[model samples]
Target: MEPIQHKIYHVDSFHSRTFLDTYCAKKPEMDLGEECLRLTMEELHYFFKFANIKGGTLIDISIGPIIFHLYSACECFKEIILLRFNDHCIIELKKWLHDRTGAFDWTHALSFVAEKEGISELSEEKDMRLKAAIKHVVKCYDDRENITDPLVLPPADCVLVTNVLDVISKDKVDFIRNLQKFTKLLKPGGQFLLYGALNATYYIVGKDKFHLFNYNENFIRKAIEQEGFVINHCQVRPRKTESDLTDFKAIIFVSAYKN
Candidate 1:
């Protein structure tokens, strides 16, 4: 018998709807959802309130079309510029933003965020607020010298990245290189919030298994520090559920500021 071979992300076909259905769907009993959706929202809510990182522009470079993490962020940042490597993700995001039919339902995630904030606002209102905060969704190429080439983006006050580097980076060097590219988008003294899985080698989207750069907390801390960013708050949550879909040991969130 032969071992199963996984397909590489970016190199292989990735279905946006499949990815959302598998991971971002409203599943209360699933630990994957609890950790990625709920825990991430909770951390961001607290981080924004405590750190007070309000600003004019924020650059978001995250995996897929997941927007749950931004529920709390819309309140803090006036404008959000979303950068994407894939066209499918951009289309899916636009569908939700424009209130098009067949968009992925994120009301459950919104409800959780509202509860955390102790707010009585309906999910529709919160969704509208988030949609308004997002200013643009632009396609990006990682291979280019300037990731956001042609349309030069203004230096942002903050940048938020979630689980993107791990999927795209082939090695530590690639990871650091991509990190540098993202950091260049930030203004001096800008905040960089990163959320990633620790000790993860792969994750499943649909039937395809995509590569993940296996890294731990120390490696991430060192990588960020090497870029001259001052670490502010770092949190790691151990994986609470048993699943064969992914092999990540924990999830990590780090808040840092460029010096």
Candidate 2:
């Protein structure tokens, strides 16, 4: 199948609600809950392990509205900055933080994270902490200019970039270029948390298919090293279910430091 003609930086069809309801939403009848639980554990294990790393500022450069990984770092970092590709994502984030009507509830995921961390509290308590921890949500992308050139923000101690490179890049060169740009946002020796699908060509969202530049562990390691990052931790999980939402044999997580 031909790839999506336009570069998709964020999920377009159902807005943030589409993503929230489809993946992050907690419905008793949903069959994908186990899959979601497994995926969250796979990704959050690294965050939980690396939470003690010295990082006063954290940056998340992910697409869509999911904030599953950020909760782990809330207690470890003083500030959290969310950078997205468009205004839609920014607005979605605001709606949640500001108590706007029609906002997708993320209490289920927040409570899950807190519980995993041994915190005995409702999701609302976690939500308030997360909201206060998040300092800003701004528009950002690495395509128009060098990744380092676009954002004039402070260098982050830890940068979370997940499921971004593959969908936004046209090919390997483009992916590598963007990777280097993202790394430049970090201070030297800062941690770079990354996650992506292995060999996934496309993923569906509300009947719309988005491209994922197929890559493997070898490619990821090479790209990180070439971009001046030292790999400290890595994990891979095999596909848990057969679903058209995404096609990939494995999900890979990497915790690296800027060298």
Candidate 3:
């Protein structure tokens, strides 16, 4: 058998529209969205509201063109900066932010977040707030020592990363290196929230398979602790949707603070 690297495609070759339709669209059947989007949104909403993680700038580094998780975040932070790994993802994000025609409809996700907040009728308002909160959407280079090279960013009050490290990292050491790079974006005592899959080796998007760094909750906890982050809350939910598109055993949500 060949190495895992030879079997999986890089995330840079990902098709944004296909990825969104495959996992984020609201379909009648049980899909990856149930665990990846809805559960993540629910956890983020609860964490932002009760964890005392509010104010200042919030930086978001995520996989694909996902904005569902940011609905609740706009309420807590004054500004949001989105960092993307490639131009395709950046374009997809801008389409939604600018209300372009072919943008993915996020109404379902917005409605779910609104319902959670007890303002089911105010979903549109919530969407508008999220749009207003986003201050910048910039491309970042993972190969560079500074992901945002030539464009230094101020330390943010909060940093949120969702399903990104696992998809991009080549190995455990690469994962830790990327984690530290993201951590450097946070201010002292700043809050950090990470949402990812557990024991996931691969996920499919538009007939293409992308690699995921297989890891467990214990590894995640140890990594964050080693990076000087105090884990405040950590929860793992068993995989609810059984699909060949992804083979993740569980989903993990972690809330921590820079110590």
lDDT of each: 0.89, 0.75, 0.87
> Candidate 1 local accuracy as lDDT?
0.89
Clashes of each: 0, 0, 0
- Model 1 lDDT per residue over 1-259, tens place: 2232566566678888888887788865554788778889999999998888989999999999888999899999999999988889999999999989999999889889889889877657888988999999999888977798988999999999999988888888889999999999999999999999999988988777888888999999999999999998999999997877799999999999988
* Candidate 1 runs further than 4 Å off: 1-5, 28-31
Task: Provide TM-scores for the models.
Answer: 0.96, 0.89, 0.95
What shift in Å separates residue 253 of candidate 1 from its native position after superposition? 0.5
Better of 2 and 3 by lDDT: 3
lDDT of 3 at 188: 94
Tens-digit lDDT track for model 3 on 93-197? 999999999999999998898889898475467888999999999888777788899899999999999988888887888899999999999999998889888
The per-prediction CA RMSD against the true structure, in angstroms, equals 2.5, 2.6, 1.7
